[model samples]
Target: MTGKKRKRIKIGDVYAIPLPNGKYAFGRIFKDAGIGIYKYIGVSIDDIPRVEEYQFIVGVYEYVLKSGVWTFVKYRPFKSDDEAFPPPSCIVDNISGEFSIYHKGEIRSATKLECEGLEVAAVWADNHIIDRIMGVDKWHKDDEK
Candidate 1:
């Protein structure tokens, strides 16, 4: 028999393992045995009991140049899906100049702002959404500083 090497698995990496029932089990590699085997924790995406529905108002902000003055305007508030998560504040894509909102690991909304000479911005979700994306509670503490 020819011996073939398998790719190494890392911790926190999601992977699929074949089961005896001819089905695949999706899980995350939690621990490594240093050998070829790895300890995996099963993940059931459809088994999540219930996710609380959260509603928030989002305001899109943009800078409009009228005459020779630049003004910032806060657009009307709009409702966002619970899955819409903002990108990290530090991750700014300079190439596309596009901002995206993600839902279920996919882009739900994308907007290309005109940033040639004007400051184009949008109010992402409320404080809760910002905190969830940033993985921090700084939004609530912003008032203290």
Candidate 2:
């Protein structure tokens, strides 16, 4: 055995993310690597935000969680009615900075205007996602130069 204990990461689990300004952001696991970072920024973990609101839903780089960068807060059951966990239908290519729509496993070209509010098709690491969430850096596919 490698002797490293694996933290149980499960669907419906919420995590407390610390921002540089002292406010906390929350992320919920909807599936393996699929997490929704909530739009609600709170003063502390005790301030539970509603699960319905979110800033971005992306496939997070698992290492960030595995390394304990984001602390587990609580678990709320995933619901059939939850709209925050939708698979990314619109995808932006990071290298080429192009946009596409991916739905039902099919991908097709999409205009930049059509990709509004969609994240680049890449797993977000800790710093990148946190900066985006904290408004330290704002990113929109159409704004890419």
Candidate 3:
């Protein structure tokens, strides 16, 4: 028998692995050293790899070991569409106790801004959503370091 070299994982290769209740899951490979850890996310439980890497793209679904069910989740888009970043001139206006974010229009929310270019209304809409996933007061605490 001719022995072949093992294949290497890439950014978009999908894998399937066994799961509980005779089920399986699917996950894609992704590497991002910035996140510091690698794991499957959106795929099935059966597809997760028992290895180490920077970050792996996971499917937003999982296999139920006991019930033998597949549950799909509403996952955010894996790829970012925008390649350009806003200039540093963006600002959030604070007047007295009221805070308004002005981009193209007035923003009306109270969450920490990820960037300052998103309009007030857009930022306001994002605040609650961002807060639920990552706390409300999220910001760089150690920028000076």
Among all candidates shown, the one with the greatest lDDT: 2
Clash pairs detected, candidate 1:
none
lDDT string for model 3 (1-145, tens) is: 0111213323433343333335443333323201111333324443344543323121122112112232221122235323111112224455644444332223444445554443222222222322322323444345445
Models 1 onward score TM values of: 0.18, 0.73, 0.23
How far is 15's C-alpha from truth in model 3 (Å)? 0.6
What ranges in model 2 sit over 4 Å off?
A: 1-6, 81-85, 92-99, 103-117, 138-145
What TM value does model 2 have?
Answer: 0.73
Worst 10 residues of 3 by lDDT: 57-66
Instruction: List residue ranges in candidate 3 displaced over 4 A.
Output: 1-6, 33-145
Give lDDT for model 2.
Answer: 0.74
Q: Which stretches of candidate 1 lie over 4 Å from their true place?
A: 1-8, 31-145
lDDT of 1 by residue, 1-145 (tens): 0112223333322223333343323322222111111122123322211222222222211111111121111111214533233222222256964655432344433454422322222343223323432346665587698
List the candidates ranked by TM-score, beginning with the highest: 2, 3, 1
Give the per-residue lDDT of model 2 (tens digit) for 1-145.
1122337876777888888998888888875367888889989866768756888887788788777667887877776634335465577777997889864346899999877766655678889889888776665654786
